[model samples]
Target chain A: MARVNATPRRRGAARTDELLEVTLELAVEVGYAGLSIEAVARRAGVGKHTIYRRWPSKAALLLDALSRVWTADLNYRGTGDVRADLREQFLRSAPALATTPIGPVYRAVIAEAQSDEALRATLHEMFLANVEQSTLDRITRAQQAGELVPDVDLTFAAEVLCGALYYRGLLSTRPIDEAAVDSLLDMFMAAYGA
Target chain B: MARVNATPRRRGAARTDELLEVTLELAVEVGYAGLSIEAVARRAGVGKHTIYRRWPSKAALLLDALSRVWTADLNYRGTGDVRADLREQFLRSAPALATTPIGPVYRAVIAEAQSDEALRATLHEMFLANVEQSTLDRITRAQQAGELVPDVDLTFAAEVLCGALYYRGLLSTRPIDEAAVDSLLDMFMAAYGA
Candidate 1:
């Protein structure tokens, strides 16, 4: 009786997973310009209304897809070494940024967001939330502990650290290697370290 | 005789200018995905063959259009003062980066460049030329004068300075205002000042 009840729930989860997987694959193959709900529906073998039921718009669907795959292993813990902590954060995130489908999807969405207000808001909100909750708090803690300069703007510091990575990933073909990671952390520490 | 000789040349130049203008406008309105040689030709009131004669592909046409309008007034002459120089550079370039048609066109091409390899090379080449010739040279000069640390990587320094602006312009809706300008210069100074 319990198995019977769980069967439909499991089936629904599997269907949602399949739809998301298709969206990720299609985003790269067709790009944001060529992507559409109808295309996703046709490719995924799901109804258009099924996608709309899960996400209000195509942008929302893409955002959901991005969130699931883009940030899978990005868990940062501060170990009192700000440089090491920041370096680790980037080193861990580098693979997803460089070689994965996440890179293309991120570039596509950001490119789309230039002309898209709704999508821009979603990206900004999601980005700011992550920075505020994790990055800002960590930096602020370091300031309190006298590990970082008291006057540094946490947001700007975060931007400088991560912006180089995003800049390279989006605009340049430069690999996000150990050297790049060291340069980013070294520069951030040079400016902000106490 | 000279007037007659120049008539066709002048007319050809005017026709090319019009086609390029339409291309720039359409890139923002419809984005790189929807932009086409047909649309540009139609909007410019020229034959499709005229556009083809001038540019070999959509990417080529877009690159040509971008080169004409963008970077028109970006003249960076750095003085001895690093803060003043950096601030002036950003100030000078802000109009092109934000207010003009150049911004949208630039954003559009960059969006397109993600999926297009040849376009990416063009962008990187153009970007690297500007940075290496002007930005990196100025920073290196300052370092030599003992205005900045000797060990600072000029390329990374240039990337950090401009990457923040590009990051905000492309990804976030943050206005590149006076405070932001001051913050960028100050941070660079903090890190590299001798």
Candidate 2:
């Protein structure tokens, strides 16, 4: 599927990736409140116009950077066992999300999204596309397979489970360890498991 | 319980309340990023030193202002029916938290808390003290009264329910309506109701 101009496209993608890597690092260190395009440009060794050409606002850049960093490995193919699938999915991401280095970046983007409409939309769209909708799809599949209760509101169930992770990530001082994930799964399954 | 010098103490409290009123108003208008003690003081017609004398940082002031504004009506006395109590509690507040004027302020404080440790501490402490711990106590009482299952993790349950509110408030564009609150209650009760 290589284009005739694949080299240029690949180079552009690589450059974009490098800029996002720096964005993630700076977002962790200074947070969204302190993040700026000029600062990112200086750090990433790119001109301000280069950054501005791609993203209209700092929020837009952070939105893209956040999606790049957070949703990089979020490929969800549901296992037959709903509990196992959910546990595996959450265990893979939630702990890393609670830990520092990248955790603050996730937190910062989420925090900044509150005030910025475009960032909020991007964050919501990214979360729905990458996380929520995928979860609902799995739940639906599980319901059809008789692994989950068919009567459960899939959206509510998904929100409840994912909301706990978001809560722990953004608010709690304690790290989201396996035990916590286990409890969350237990609560989730006890309600919706067939 | 009025003292002879209650007038001066009341005056101090009134002054703080006025300052926080302006803080909440500006927070709604300009958000946490644009909010400053100087601006708040200017709006409230107070000296900068007067604002600084009481609050060391904007985050502190916002923390206080947020608590003052948001936690004003969080009356969570258990009425023996755990489900009904929780539903009423959430239905009353979630809509308000989702609506504008105050919703953005709540969102702003939460957003600022991610990068600011002191604000995070204040937010966490305030949440635990005013919201989570109280919810846990109600859940415990429900367990004792045979309204809720004995073995559910109260903390996890509280977090899940409150987390949904937080998620919807800060992230979703849709309001956390009565039906949503009812569904949330049904989900919570399904897992924990005896």
Two-chain DockQ for each candidate model? 0.48, 0.52
Give the alpha carbon lDDT tens digit for every residue of A154-180 in model 1: 777776666677777667767788888
Candidate 2 CAPRI category? medium
Q: For this target, which candidate reaches the highest lDDT against the unseen true structure?
A: 2
Which stretch of 10 consecutive residues in model 2 chain A shows the poorest summed lDDT?
A70-79
Q: Candidate 2 on B83-156: residue-level lDDT in tens?
A: 88888788777755557877777777787788676677777775544677767777888998998888656777
Count of residue pairs whose backbone atoms collide, per candidate = 0, 0
The worst-scoring run of ten residues by lDDT in candidate 1 chain B lies at B69-78
- Per residue, candidate 2 scores C-alpha lDDT tens digits across A1-194 of 57868999989999999998888788778877798999999999989999999988787787778677667346565668877777778877775555687766777777778777767777777554467777777788999999878766678777777777777777766567788788888877777778
CAPRI accuracy category, model 1: acceptable
Candidate 1 wrong stretches, greater than 4 Å: A1-54, A128-133, B1-73
| DockQ, prediction 2 | 0.52
Interface RMSD for model 2 amounts to 1.5
